[model samples]
Target: MSNVILMIFTGLSVGAVYFLLGSGLALIFGLMRVLTFAHGAYLTACAYAGWFILRHSSLAAGPSIGTLLLALLVGVVVGGALAFLTERVLLRALYQRDHLDQLLVTAGLGFSLVALLNGIWGPDSRAVPTPPWFTRTTTDIFGAHIARGDFVLIGVAVLLLIALEAFLKHTRHGLVVRAGVENREMVRALGIDVRRSFTLIFTVGGAVAGLGGVLAALYANAVNTTIGDTYLLYAFIVLVVGGLGSLRGAAIAALAVGLLQQFANFYVNPGLGEILSFILMGAMLLLRPEGVGGKKIRLI
Candidate 1:
């Protein structure tokens, strides 16, 4: 019983990480109508940027909250700036072109950037520095030994989720974003320069990816070149199951997949969780193409 509880909590934290990655993908795909293959590169780069700050800066002597916050800030800024540039330069050229062309270009960018990261950072994982108070220590919870870090990740995810929901449902900018997702043509026809929204959307998406990258490193206790790649695939599955424009769906799908994978891996086999997740994605594609939320971002 304790084991089950532990797994659930662990799964929630894992799911929190997934949500961080997926939510960004969702927002980008939701508004831009472009599958952001370059997003993985954004994550990987920002993560490395943050890691470099922490591992090499003055704060490297010891764990400090300043180190943590600075790394996160750098990641977010770099991510957002990279995304803004990509949208203004690379993406704009392919706007009128075929989506396959867009995909190919972005995928190439993603691959090339990752390769650069490998060359620069080397193909190995580096331990992430945490605060002195921070450790992968386990605490008792209802007879379950839960990692303290799990609570941190889960709490952060939850807070971000609330902030996002409020932003989308209340803010004027967010309303434009939702409207753009629902009907880009209509939004444009209404005399709103949706192009501005496009850049904002991309920036927001990239910022989310950046935040996820930092948090992911902290969660895993390390940073690696391929860390974002592993999560990007799962995040795509999340988009498929949750729908392209639904944060609510992304959250639910993330948690479900996280829990399912953890439980299956523990009880059944080590890698079966990933296999099962893919299977679930296939099932969802065939049975509910509109997604679990029954929301479809019209392709037009």
Candidate 2:
């Protein structure tokens, strides 16, 4: 029973990160109709940025709370800036192009980002150690040992999810974004600045990805050039399983995936965990191509 509880907590933490990352991808796809292959690159870049800050800054060995906060902030700023630049310079040119063209452009951008990361960070595995407080702290509940880091991650995820829901449902900017998603031409016809809304959504999406990256780095205690690739497939799986353009779907899908993966890892081989996740996703796709909570989409 204690083991089950521990697994549940751990799964929730991981699920939260997946939710954020998958949500960003889904939002971009729904709003822009562009499949961004560069999203994984952005996530990798954020991870590296967090690793760099932790290695070189004075906060590397301080209280875990402060260090984690600082790293998350840095990740958000850097990721958001990168997204803004990419949209303005590259994505803007492909906005009116066909899906094939957009895919090719984004794929090229992703390759270029990989090359750039290699040049800067080299091909080495780097670890982001948990701070002193986190390393030493543990709580016993129902005869199970729970790390403080897990609690912190779950808390942050809950807060961010609520905030994102409120932003989309209650804010004017969010309404414009939703409008653009539904009918870009109609939004423009109504004298709204659709471009600005796109930019805002892109930035926000990037920030969310960055936050996920930071949490991943802290939890795994390692950052490498291929870290993005590791999570990219999983993020896409979550997006597909959750439904496109639906935050609620993404959240629910993430939790389901996380818990499923965690229990599979515990009862089965860890190496096969990803394979199992893929299998689950594939089954969902075959049975409900529209996703668990998405409207039916026609494929060309």
Candidate 3:
């Protein structure tokens, strides 16, 4: 029983990061209607940024909670900046083009970004330095041993999810975003400055991805140039299962996928775990067609 609990907790811990990444992708797709291939790049870059800062800076001696927080701040800022640049310089040019053009451009850009990362960080994997506090802390529950950091990761994800839901449902800016997702033309008709909203949403999405990168890196005790690619693939699966625009669905699907993957990996072949995830996704598509929380809408 304790082993089962541990496996479930492990699944939830990993799923929280996927939820963060998938929710960002869903937001960008739902609102901007553009498939951002560069998102994974953003995540990788931020992880690298955090890794670099923590390793090279004064914090390298013995990182504390404050040091980790600073690294996180750096990661998020870099992610947002990169997203801003991508939006202003690259994505803006394709707003009027069809989805195919946008996808091609972003895909090309993603490959280029990956190459850039390889060139800069090299092909070797790097580890994120966890603060001593995180490593030293542990708790026991029902005969199961758990790391405080794992719980921290789960807590952060849950809080962020709740805050985002509140923001979208309660705040004026979030309401505008939700409305824009539904009808960009209608929002523009109301003089809501839809373009600015687009920029904001895209930047926020990037920031969320960056946060995920940092958290995942800490959990894995490593980062690599290909980290983004791995997570990006999983993010798409989560988005597909959750529905394109539904944050709630992303959260639930992320947990489901994480649990499924972990359980399969433990009881079956590691390769089979990923295969099971895909099978689940295929079944969901055949049954729901529109996704778990997705509404039928014409993709423009």
Candidate 4:
């Protein structure tokens, strides 16, 4: 029972990061119709940024809660800035073009960003330095030790879910974003600036991804150039299963995927976690019964 509890926490911890990526991807594709390949790059860059702050900066001597907060803030800012540039400079012109063109452009940008990361940080993994509190388990329940870091990931993800839901459902800006997703031209005709909403949503997606990147490093106990790549595809699976433009689904699916992967890997084969996740995704697609192209612009 204790072993099982530990696995559950571990799975939830992994899923929390995936939720950040999945939710961000769903929100972006939901509103902008742009499946950003560069999102993983955002995660990677932000992780690097966070790592530098925590390890190479003035805080490196005696990192604490304040240091962690600062690192997370830097990561979020970096992610937002990168996303703003992508939306304004590269994606704005191609929104009206064929989806293939947009896909190619984003894909190319993602590759370039990865190359830049490799150039700056090199290909080696950097050790993530955590505060002592993070490593110390708060308590051992039935011999299942629960680390403080796990709670941090889980809590942040839950809070983010609530905040975004409130933002989209309650505020005027949320209304604009929802309307913009449904029909940008109609919103534009109403004299609402849908482009700003586009940029806003995209920036939010990037910002969330950036936050995830830092938390992910903390979760894994290390950082690497390919850290974002590690979670990117699985997150897309979560996005697809949850449905595009649906934060509700993404939230639920993230927990489900994370739990499934963790349990499967432990009780079954060592690498069966991802295989089972794909099976779950397939099951979801079968139930939806949508055409491939339709799925691209699908809101559900």
Per-candidate RMSD vs. true structure?
A: 1.9, 1.9, 1.8, 2.6
Give candidate 2 regions above 4 Å deviation.
58-64, 297-299
TM-score of 3: 0.94
TM-score of each: 0.93, 0.93, 0.94, 0.94
Candidate 2: C-alpha RMSD to true structure equals 1.9
Q: What is the model-wide C-alpha lDDT for candidate 4?
A: 0.86
Candidate 1 — which residues are off by over 4 angstroms?
A: 57-60, 136-139, 183-186, 297-300
**Candidate that beats the other on TM-score, 2 or 3, i.e. the better one:** 3
Please give, for residues 1-300, the per-residue lDDT of candidate 4 as tens digits.
998999999888888999998889988887678868888989999998998888865444777889999999999999999999999999999888777887788889888999998998799988888888988898897889999989999999999999998988998888998888778889999999988878888999999999999999988878988998888988888887777777877887898999998999899998898889899888878876231223433422
Report residue 214 deviation for candidate 2 (angstroms).
1.3
lDDT: worst 10-residue window of model 1 = 130-139
**lDDT at 3, model 4:** 86
Candidate 4 wrong stretches, greater than 4 Å: 57-60, 289-300
- Which residue runs of candidate 3 sit more than 4 Å off their true CA positions? 57-60, 296-300
Shift in Å, residue 236, candidate 3: 0.4
Clashing pairs for model 1 are none
Each prediction's whole-model lDDT (CA): 0.84, 0.80, 0.82, 0.86
Q: Is candidate 1 or candidate 4 better by lDDT?
A: 4
Question: Candidate 1 vs candidate 4: which has greater TM-score?
Answer: 4
Residue pairs of candidate 3 with colliding backbone atoms: none
